[model samples]
Target: METQNYIEYELVDSVSDRNIMTDSREEAIHAFEKGWTVYEHHNTINQHSKFTQSNLTVTMMWNDNPEFQGS
Candidate 1:
C-alpha cells in the first residue's frame, strides 16, 4: 500500500527529507511481527543457513527513523 500511496500527489501537501538513521531493535522486531500477522501477510523471513551454530538466529536490519535506510 505504501508504494501506491503516492498516486494522489495532490493530497500529499508536502514531503519531508531525512538524513541519517540509526536502528535500535525495531528492525529485528518488525520482521518477527510481520511473519506472525496472517491478516497482513506482507511477510519477511530470514534464514542463516551458513551459520550452523544453534545459537545463531535471523535478525532484520533496522534503520532509525529519518533516513529509513539500513545502518
Candidate 2:
C-alpha cells in the first residue's frame, strides 16, 4: 500500500524566530508554555518505506512581546 506522511503541527518563536517539528501534542504545548506559538499542520502522510516507518511532524511558533522583554 502507498501512504503519505505530513507535518501535524508548526511551532515558531517570534522573539527568536526559532522553529521545531514534533510528533506529539504534549511537546507542542510545552513549547507554547515557554512563550512559543503552536500551529497545527494539516497535510497528507508520506508513504513509508519497507524498512523505514513514517513519523508525524508538529510545528510551534513563539514571539517575544515587547512589553515583556525586560521581565
Candidate 3:
C-alpha cells in the first residue's frame, strides 16, 4: 500500500461553531458568499510497515462580517 493524500474545504460559522465540508473550491466560495467562512483543509496519511500517521492542514480563505454570523 501507499500513502494517500486528501483535500477538502470547510464552510464554517465561526461564532456558532457550525461547519460543513465541501469537495471543491467553487463550493467553498459559494458557501462563503452565503455568509459562511471558508477554509481549505489538506490531509496526508503516511503508511509504514508497522503503522500509519495522518496529518491535517488548514487555511482560512474568506470570512464574512462578524455582525452577520451566518444570517
Predicted model with the maximum TM-score? 2
Instruction: Score residue 68 of candidate 1 by CA lDDT.
Output: 19
Tens digits of lDDT, candidate 1, 1-71:
44421110001111232222223234333433433211111123211111112432323232223221323
Clashing pairs in 1: 22-64
Winner by lDDT = 3
Better of 1 and 2 by lDDT: 2
Candidate 3 lDDT for residue 1: 95
Can you write out model 3's per-residue Cα lDDT over 1-71, one digit (the tens) per residue? 96667767657776788878777867766676666766554555221110012222232322333432335
Error of 1 at 27 (Å): 0.5
For residues 1-71, write the lDDT of model 2, one tens digit per residue.
75565545456688997877676778876776676766555455331111111232222222323332222
TM-score for each candidate, following the candidate numbering: 0.17, 0.49, 0.48
lDDT pick, better of 1 and 3 = 3
Error of 1 at 19 (Å): 26
Whose TM-score is higher: candidate 2's or candidate 3's? 2
> What lDDT is reached at residue 20 by model 2?
73
TM-score of 2: 0.49
TM-score: model 1 vs. ground truth: 0.17
